[model samples]
Target: MNKVELVYRELLFQALEKNNFLLTQKELSNLLSMSLSTVNLSLKPLRRMNAIKVNPMNLKTINPRKVLLYWASVRNLNKDIAYQTRVDVSISEIEKNIPANCIFGAYSAYKFRFKEVPADYSEVYVYADSLDEIKKRFPSKSGQPNLFVILKDVNMGRYGKITSLAQTFVDIWNLGEWYSSDFIKALEMRINGILE
Candidate 1:
């Protein structure tokens, strides 16, 4: 993920999860360890889309959905794939065997976060810096891949077992799977509920 995406993630996380839509550019720069100009560049699209109102002192997010969709539109999910292989196991078994220090993403993330799945899914995505354990467990095979390991960014900061709500939504939106739209619709409903 780029620094700009990180800014979007933090903005969405604050607006959706924390319900604190008002924040400062300097604060974002400090929290994300980026320069103030980088934060400004990231907010450009949102400002143009009328998703946020920026002042010299603080910026207020008025349309989080726009911010989310913008991030989803630009996110390159496949570029982060560090490892992928065909795990000839049930989805449950594949999820169960994911090694420690990995963050669940996409379908698995939605399931873990919501404790319900909108549709049945066939693949598992995870973010991890280390992949020796995963490579050993699910060796590369000459078949369709069911397990994808996204390379974790060093600056991706802390989160729970699953990816952040914004991250999960963007990741699912970038997926080409047949059921990804199902998850996207379900997540939109959930996010709308939260925003309401």
Candidate 2:
């Protein structure tokens, strides 16, 4: 993921998870290790969409859904795929076999985050810093991919276990599966509940 997406992730995480919608550019820069200009650039769309109020001292998120959809629109989840393999095992077994260091994404992310599956899903996606363990476990197969390992960003560690709400939303938005829409609808309801 790019630095701009990282800013959206942090901002959404704060607003949705932490219940803190206001932050200064310097604080965001420090949290994501980005420059002030980069953080400023990331906020431009939010500002234009009237999703945030950017005062001199701080920025307040007024519409997190707008921010989320903006990120989802710009997110390139496919480009972040670091490794892909056909894990023929059941989805549960495949999830269990994932490396401990990985952060679950896509279908598995919705299950982990919400403790329920919106619909039956066939694939598992994860973000991992290294693929050695996954490679050893899943190996290679000849069929279509059921497991995808996304390249983990340096700042991803801030969200433990599963990917953050924004990350999960954007990732699911990029998927083509029919059940992916189910997950997206469930997530939107959940996010609306949180941000309400």
Q: Considering every candidate listed, which one attains the maximal TM-score?
A: 2
Put down candidate 2 lDDT per residue, 80-139, tens digits, no spaces.
Answer: 898898977899999988889999988898898778988999999999989898899989
Residue 87 deviation, candidate 1, in Å?
Answer: 0.6
Q: lDDT tens string, model 1, 8-104?
A: 9999989888889999999999988899999999999999999999998899999999999999999999998889999888999999999878889
Instruction: List the candidate 2 regions with Cα displacement exceeding 4 Å.
Output: none
Which residue segments of model 1 deviate by more than 4 Å? none
What are the TM-scores, per candidate, against the unseen true structure?
0.96, 0.97
